[model samples]
Target: MTTETPTPLVDFTAAAAEARAIADAAGVVITAVDEVTAARRVNQLAERVWGPGVGTAVDLVTALAHAGGVALLAAQGTAGEPATDVGFALGFLGWSDGLHLHSHQVGVAPEHRSRGVGLALKLAQRAVCLEHGVRLMRWTFDPLLAPNAHFNLARLGASGTAFLPDFYGQMADSINAGDRSDRLEISWRLDRALPSKRPAAPQANESLVLEADSRGWPHPTGEPLGPGCAVEIPGNYSELRQLADPRAPAWRQAVGETLAGAFAAGLTVAEFRNSRYLLAAPHRP
Candidate 1:
């Protein structure tokens, strides 16, 4: 977006105010953390290995300014923590905002998540991108999340080209939970306004391939893969794969056989994105 140089120090007051407004409307609160607190969180993210720390945010803001400026977002309670938390991310289209090089950092409050706040923050970020002539904004996230998968792929229409494993190696957080830390490097191609297109017409006669795994041909067992080169695919792929398995009756009960069957019929499978399968053209030699 128009990467306006946000004040060196983000106006926590104004950001807090906007957060409060949104929270109040929803009967929740979004609070901003000071540099100290932000810094600590950043430190924790750095020292510890589960969630991102305040340092990460600091870096984002710094790079934003360097790339022309980044907007730091926070959502929490009135004073302590936000009843609803949100982050607004902005970065130069071409400028890399450090932390693996990206230009946005919008997100929602952990406790106050859902309810469409992430989308709102993203929409707002897009406005900034447009204002600044940013054509492609990028970010990274774990590939196994079903919710985020649908959000990024089905919702925002982003495309992927990279895959980084143990991107941070290992985090001491519970969210990494049981899975290995593999991340998808994706780009939100905002070069142009989004298209007013509808979902693809269902091919009733065709079976859909809901998810792919690492074992299949395209994956090629230890084939070349990395952060800057991968593609997008569905989320909750592991769970979905189990469901899609013919032996599982519940799989058909959920997505239904038609959609899943059609997908399988139409596409060639690609690499494994943390248990989920990404479809792509057969690789060129």
Candidate 2:
């Protein structure tokens, strides 16, 4: 795959301020984790987000922090009260054509969902990367999860670059036990402005490559490759998994194959809206 031109240097001061403001608005305090105790807290938070028997070791988290990588913890509390860790983000330096940060894992506590905690953690991560002279950050996430897709592509203004099928093989975690570990790799340019707040509704002529039925079962439309198309995923994938619905696996396979094919056909994920990924033709030189 080809790489885009590097973004110009961002205003580190402004970025850090924005991160702090976001954390404050979310009623959390964001801080770097360099001590063993903080690293353990990160690991515990990860286990709670994923499941037992699955999380980065405390030693590794500390090593990454000491090595100049990002290891941040977000907690909620006030003065005179003990702060409780509610979210954490971990990443390390990477080389992809040039230097960048590969965000490994980021999670928020269950009770903190929909409270802007995840966005705050990500903006803080972006600020740390900019401070370290890195303008790009990449991460992989399950494409079937609409909330995550919106967070990465829409909220953070990242774009999906590649579709990786079964990227992690079989995961033993509670959230992904029987599901395929297919992922969409996304790239975030920290120097760029956040995406506009306008809605990303599909255009009139955009074809539907994959869509969900009324009952939420995924179906491939077999639409021909075109300059614009959209792929719809389930809005409540976790509920499907919880109920052991047979259509859950089907949605995974169908959406994965459809998106993989779209990427292979020179289509790029332009935006995600209404639980759908809108793909556009690659830009010409």
Provide the TM-score for each candidate, comma-separated.
Answer: 0.50, 0.93
Residue-wise lDDT of candidate 2 within 1-285, one digit each (tens)?
999775444577888888889899999999999799999999999999998878789999999998978999999998999998899999998898568899999999898988989999999999998887788899999998999999999998888888999999999988888888999998888977777678776578778988887877887887886667889899988898899899888988888888888889888887899888989876432
Model 1 residue runs over 4 Å out of place are: 1-68, 74-85, 88-104, 195-278, 281-285
Q: How many Å off is the CA of 93 in candidate 2?
A: 0.9
Q: Model-by-model lDDT, in order? A: 0.44, 0.88
lDDT accuracy of residue 83 in candidate 2: 95
Which numbered prediction scores highest in TM-score against the true structure? 2
Q: Looking at candidate 1, what is the lDDT of residue 165?
A: 57
Model 1 deviation from the true structure expressed as Cα RMSD, one decimal place:
11.5
Kindly list the per-residue Cα lDDT of model 1 for residues 57-142, writing each as its tens digit. Answer: 45544444454454534444566653333443444445454222264345444554677556655544554544455545677676
What is the lDDT for 214 in model 2?
A: 80
**What's the residue-level lDDT of 224 in candidate 1?**
32
Worst 10 residues of 1 by lDDT: 216-225
lDDT score of residue 39 within candidate 1: 37
